[model samples]
Every structure is written in C-alpha cells, then in structure tokens.
Target chain A: MICLAAFIVFAILGIFSATHRRLAKQAFWCVLRRVTFKPCQASIGEILKGKIVGWLLRRKSRWAGWVHRYFEVFSWIFVIITLVSTFYTVKGAYFYIRYGTCNPEHPEQCLISTQAALEKGVINPYYCNDK
Target chain B: MVENSWKSQFPFLMQKKNGQPLIYFDNACMTPCPIPVLEAMEKYNKEFFSCGGRSNTHFGRDVDDKVEETRELVAKFIGAGASQEIIFTKNATEGINLVARGLNLHAGERVLVSDREHNSNLIVWQVLQKERGIELMILPSKSDETFDLAGLEAELQKGIKLVSVVYSSNLDGYTLPVEEIVKLARKYDAFVMLDGAQAVPHHAVNVKKLGVDFLAFSGHKMTAPSGIGVLYGRLAHLENLSSLLCGGHSVKDSRYNGFELEDIPARFEAGLQNYGGIIGLGEAIKFIKQVGFDFIAKQEFELNYFITRELKQIGGINFVGVDDPKSRGGIVNFYHEKMDSNQLTIFLDESANILTRSGRHCVHSWYNSRGVKDSIRISSYFYNTIDEAEKLISALKKILGLV
Candidate 1:
C-alpha cells in the first residue's frame, strides 16, 4: 500500500530529478510485484518508512512511535487520499474540457469559469448546467 | 582521528550536515578527492587546457609532459618495468574490456575466473563465451569463502589459457592468494590478469615483484577524479597485444588503405587523453606517498576492527566477508535478518549522515548464487575517524531496535 503511494509521489517527482526517477522505477516494480500477488520488493516504501520515521524520531518522538506502530494503516490512508484526490482531479479536468467549467453543477466556484462567466454577464450555475 | 592522519586533508570530511560531520564509509566505490588532487586538476584546466600528444603549441607540450610524468608516476607506484606499460583509461571497466578484447581468444579456448568476480570482470568473459564460443570456467571457492587453490589447480589442469580474478573481493574483502594464483598460472603457461581496483589504494602491489601480466585500477578509487584509470601491462605483452581503439594518437603512418600503429602506451591510448584527470591522478599518487601505506593500513585496521567488534554485539546481523578485520582491511559488510539492506542503508543515512553502499554492489552473481537478496557494505579509508565509526554504530543500533 505504501509502495502504491510512493509510486505516485516518486512518479510526480521524477519529472525533475534523476535520483527520484530511479526511485520511481523501483516503486513501479514494487507495485507490479504487489499487483501480481508476489512478495512486495518494496525497497522504495521501506526507504520512505525509514525517512519518515527517522525524521519524526528526531523532532517528535511520540508521533514517531505512533507512526512506527501503525505504518500500514497510514499507508492505506495515504493511498486512499491519493486515489480520492486523483479521481476528483480527473473528473474536474474532464468537466472543464467539455463544459468550460471545472464543475458543471457549481460553475461559479471555479475561478476559470467564474471569470469568463462574469465577463459574459452570465454568473449563474444554470449557464453551464445546460450541458 | 588518528595521529598524523590524512583525515583533515580531505575536504569532504571538513563538510558538515545538520551541524555534524558527514560519516563517509563508501570508499570502496570511490574516495573523495583531497585538496591537492583538486588543485592539480584545477591548475591544469585553468592554466593550460590542451590536448596531449596531439597539439604542437606550448599548452599541448605542457599537457604531454604532465601526461608522461603521470605515466611514470603510475609505473613507479605499481613497480612496472617501464612507463610505456601504463595505459590511461576511463575506468577499470574499460581497462578490463581493453584486455578481454585485445587477447583475441579463439573458439574452444578456456579462461578461468573465480565464483566471486565482479560484473565488469565476469560479463566480458560471458559475452566472449556466447559470441566467440570460448570455454569459461568458474573456479569455486572453499566453504569458508576464501580462494580455493586446489580448485584453481584443477581448472589449470584442464588447459586454461588465462586466469583473471579480483586481487581483493569487493563483496567480502577477501584477498585472493594472487602470488600463488600467478605461480600456478605460470606453471600452466597461462596469462594472468589481476583486477586491482580494490587492492591498489589499500595495498602495496609491485608488478615487477608480484609478476602479473596485466593489472587494472581506477583513479577515482584512490582520491583522484573520475573518468581516469590505469591499465599496467607487461612491456612484451602490450607490444604483442592488439589495440582496441584507432584514429588520432593510435596511428603513426596513415594512408588511403592501411596504417601503422603507434608504439606501446600511445597505441592503446587512441583518442584525446584526459589531461586534467591524469594530472589529478598523479597528484593523488604523490599525496598517497606522502601519507604512506603503513599509516593507511593501520588507520583502516583500527576503524574496521572497531566497526566489526561493535557490530558483533548487535545481534540479528549476518556479517559478510571473512570474520577477521585485519584480513578484510577497510571493508566490513553485513545485513539484518529482519530488515532489508535498502531500508537499513537509508535509515543509516537518515539517522546520521553516514554514507554507505547497499545491495549486491555489482557482484550480483555471488549473492544470487548464495540466495542472499541484499547486503549493506561499509568500506572505510584513512580519511574516516573513530567518531564516525561510533556514530555509525549508534545509528545502526537504533535502526535495529536495540536502543
């Protein structure tokens, strides 16, 4: 689970750094192993655990103990949060591409649509809701 | 730091991370450059940056002189017959390739290697076996993981043409009985080449006295800059050996059809040489001489002994290499049964600024053959101090949940 979250994080960071790109590749392989039901060779996830735990151990000992104890639960939470955010981001991009508003039901809340709508004097949800 | 130590001489040791000195124990991979080596390269680059053995200008002449001086320095350092025996290369890998291809082995010929050879040494022979149909035999070590002289003799009896092995095992820090290996190879009338990458910086190897046909090592492993290596070949063998590169400095008389090759070292060194790296390597060798090998050996022994002795009390750790710290020199490797080496390595880095190497360390064959997945290797040098070793012990103990 942590490997999944690490893959996403490293995949995004891979755009800038070669070091992160290598970790992204490692995380990709670990994710593949997990999906295939093989033993997870989650070297990236383990390194991430060490980094997070090591950082916390230095600054916040109580948080470090809690994190070390429930690392798996935190991994699942991270994965869930990432998945939910990804779904909403993709949905928003699709609505924006098709209807000129990130949210068709609440076009006024989206600044890109709100600014354009304000210029056209149609600052109401009903304008984008027609689609 | 030890008395009269070269620790303060290294600029990397002077650097601090999070208000503490960074503990660097990855010297087997490459040593950090000292002020002298860096200054030499910077002087070459800043003052007279030109191609050696090519240009006729003043700068080129200076480069040529410096390159030749470095060649002499390397030759003297290794106790070679002449400076012509030293061939400058990019790294030990390139040097190995130069010899492997230059030998021009035929089908059905045999080359013997140890079971614990590095990828650079093993891969070339494997390629030769597949492409050229040469018989490549791996001589197995003893149960104790040391070099098996009997197994070498058995392989030699089968008409082995060449014997190529690491002078010191990078994985285990086990020094091979190279003298005996060379003696047996001579009995079988086989050419011997020693991969001296790990041995050159830590040990005093005299090619004239030790008597191996070819020896290869990288400059970066000895506190010089990267992209520079040395391949010392016997004067007779280098003359007979085929050149792997062509054009520029390689040729003497070129025509439309064919050309005559240049002499010994120049023949092997084909293109424009790395003038800066060569100058830096010369300075590094000079600095090493100033520090002396006796001090280096003592410093490494003290640090490695402390590390191994402390690690012994930290249970659940499987030590790599032979048990003797003196035999292992500066290298000490191990892995935890509960924790994978990758995480342990990162934890060591995160807890303290302890730089180390992990995984099979380019010797995947040894680990795969033994069914071990990973390992954490801690290789020290003279620059490392006891304080760094103590910090590494503390961090490792914490990582292992001992504290």
Candidate 2:
C-alpha cells in the first residue's frame, strides 16, 4: 500500500509536469530510466533540481540549491513516514488476524474480538474485567 | 445536550496513530464497523463456520437459519414488505448493475437519472444506453443543488421507462426529493430505482412509504463489512426482474437443456454468498436500531452545522452545494481557489492526523459538465463530535495558511 501510494504521488507529479514542455520531457525520461534500470547521463537529483529550481538557480544559484536540498530532505521524510505508517498498519492487521486484537494489552481495542463477544452475548475474556 | 457516548462504541474512533488521535471524517466513503457488527462476523467464522443456505448438516442449517433471520431483520429495518424483497449482492454497484441489466429495456426506451448521481448509478445507465439503444435522460438539478422536480416532471411527460437516481448526493450530501420523484415517475408508469448508498446509513429509509420500486445500498457505508450490500425491490419487481447471475443455489433443478429457478430473493442471490458479511450487516442494522435514526441525525447535524459555520469564516473556500447546513446531509464539500484539493487533503492527514477525501468524488460528470474540477469532502457521522469538527476547522485554517 505504501509503495502504491508513492507510485500514485509520482504518477500525479509526472502528469502535472507534463503541462510544461521542458519538464514533461525530463519527467517522462526519468520515468523511462527508472522503469528500464538504465543509467542516465545526469543524476535524478540533479535533473529534478535543475528542472524545478532552474529559473531560481539562474537568478540566485546558492538560494535555489539550498531550497532544492530542503525539498529533497522533505521528500525523503515523507517517504519514511509513509513506510513507517504502512509497517504499523500491516503489523496491526497481522496482530488482529492472529489474536483478534491489534494490541493485546488492551483487548477492548480489538474490534473483531469485541464485536464477536458482543454478538455472542459473551464478555471479551481479556478486557471484560477491566474497568 | 446530545450525548456523544456513541464514539465509545467504535474502537477505531479511539485509535491513535503517531501519538495523535485519528480524526476520521471520511464516513461517506465508508465507516469503521462497530464492535457488535464485528462480533457477529467473528461469531459466524469461529463457531458456525459452514456454507449457508445449501447444506443439510447441523452447522449448515444453523448458518442458513441465521442468514434468513438476517434477511428478515434487514427487510424490517428498511421497511420492505417481505424478506423476499431483499437480495444480497457484493456491493451497491453490483445491485445497480443487476437492476439496470435485468430490467430488459427495449430500444428507444428512456431512463432518467439526476445530474448528481455517483458513477455507479450513472455509468450503468450509460452502458445500457450504449448496448441496448436506450436513451439516457439527464434530470437537471436546481441552482441550490436540490433535485429539479419540475425538470423531472417534464422528463416524465416524455415517457421514461425508468427513473434511477441517487437518494443522496455523495458529493454534497444533498438529498433528492425521493418521495416526490417516485410519485412523478409512477404517474408516467415508470419504474423508480434509488441508489441509496449514501442515504441508507444516515437516514431511516422506508421503501414502502417512499413508494420506490427499488433501493440499493452498501452495508460497509453503514458499519458492516465491505463485501455485503442489499438490493430491495418490491415483490412484483423482484419476481419479474431477470436474474443477473445463475448457477448453484439460484436454481431449484437443472439440466443440460433447461433449468428451474428458485423464488424471488434466492433466484437473484447466486453462489455461496458472503455469509460473514451478511451476518455482520444483520448486527449493523441492530446497532443502528439501538442507536435510533433520530439520535444519529441529531449528532451528525451538530457536527455538520458546527463545521459549516466555521468553514464560512475561512477565506477562499467555496462550498459545493447549498449554503444552509440543514439543506444537506452530514457532508461538507468545498474547494479553495488558491489551494489544490489533493494537497490540502494530504496536509490535513500529515499535519493533524485528520483523514478526508478530495477529488471529483465519483461524480465526475457533474464536475465535468460544470467545468469544475476537484473538491475536498468532509463527511461526519454519529461517532464524530463537535471537538473533532473544531479540530478539522483549525487544521483547515492552518492548511489554508490562515493561521
């Protein structure tokens, strides 16, 4: 799910960039290179930075490079967040499947188990005694 | 004072992610199943784990009895005349398709659908038009996003065979005048089918009182599992409408040349069925009944009204439908002229842990026709509260760069 989310973001970015003639060529080329595992003449970072901050770089190279670097950092942070969230979500699902609760310590928090108990008119043995 | 105690019933509402409480305002898309509903499904899977409606074994018979009991309960909940009127499907989309494909409209016959229908309701008719040479008529809405009754009357005069429409708009939560629409359609001898996917969860739908020939809705939208949905047709319609699928339990007897079909509901429901989901849906209806529609409506209204009032103070925000919160259901769809909807949605998710939906919301034709693009949708439910609404507004303010 996390990979799909990242791919969707990239695809949307690619589509948005397609409106720009120069950036469209570069974006498509980047996609092609990534798909085929071909070595590109320019690094992806350089290509993206040059395209996005090219105008800024022409006027103020230092400021543009600084902003571009921050952009790269933010992108990595977003990716990391997505990965961590996806890991937890998958982990929760596994726990729920195995124990009928995402968190065994708080069995009432397990929706599946709670619902099962509720339907059967029985108390959730793990959490029923807890206030 | 309205008791906000219902929030405790949904475990997901209590869930925290990244040390922040997950504020879910995407109930229109789907709702998290309450404990009882989940329990019902779990009970089915754990204790009575058997194929339903086909086996003579003790477990199978018990499962069959439970499935039938669920059918009766669903029928009673929706005010259907009999349990046979309800047919279980994979989801509302399949229900709509079953009706569209089963009705067997002839060439040049027309079907009228409103402009605000979700893609599921709209695309099926379009497909029918393309394949069967049937004319698809668009029932235009009034400026305030309510159904144009006069426009529907005009269309009815032109001889429509069927009038299929959304019970409530998923985009803006504006409910069409279904009672009036049904009366008008009946005057022209037209069959009426309502896509009640949005309406059924929030409102008490009495098909008999509404006088509609058919109503389809998804169980997941109303706190049941995803795979289960209900298609309620009047007894006569179910008896006459062609079965979309065949084989297995759908038939009484079969041979190479010919086969005998079962009764109304069973004839339409083919294969083994989603027994777990069906049982969960039964429990969901029980939960809804216990909560009562009046309380649900009041709770949703409080949240929606509060959010709408707050959103009005924000600059650059344009609401999709009527300005009055009372005029719509629990949905608030808006777009910022200066901000991208998707970007705003992501910002809210990342910054505040508030989940929402942004896009054309499956009403692409409505957006495309009006030259409007994407919008953000915040749909509140009974489980949501004013505090959550306030949180959403604060997040929106920050995302709009207002704070």
Winning model by lDDT? 1
lDDT at A77, model 2? 72
Q: Compose the digit string of candidate 2's lDDT tens values, residues B251-281.
A: 9999999999998899998899999999999
For candidate 2, give the docking quality class from DockQ: incorrect
lDDT of each: 0.87, 0.82
The ten-residue window of minimal lDDT in model 1 chain B covers B1-10
Give the per-residue lDDT of model 1 (tens digit) for B1-403: 4755577788887788666578899999999899999899999999999988989999999999999999999999999989999999999988998999999999999999999899999999999999999999998888888889998998899899999999988887788999999999999999999999999998899998888999999999999999999999999888778877887999898999999998888989988888899999999999999888988899889998999999999888898757888789799999988877877777777767788988898999989888899899999887788878898998788667722
DockQ of each: 0.43, 0.02
Candidate 2 lDDT over residue span A38-95, tens digit each: 6333333343433444444334555544654486465567667866876877777776
Off-target runs (Cα >4 Å) in candidate 2 are A1-131
Per-model TM-score, in order, reads 0.92, 0.78
Off by over 4 Å in 1: A9-29, A38-44, A93-131, B1-5
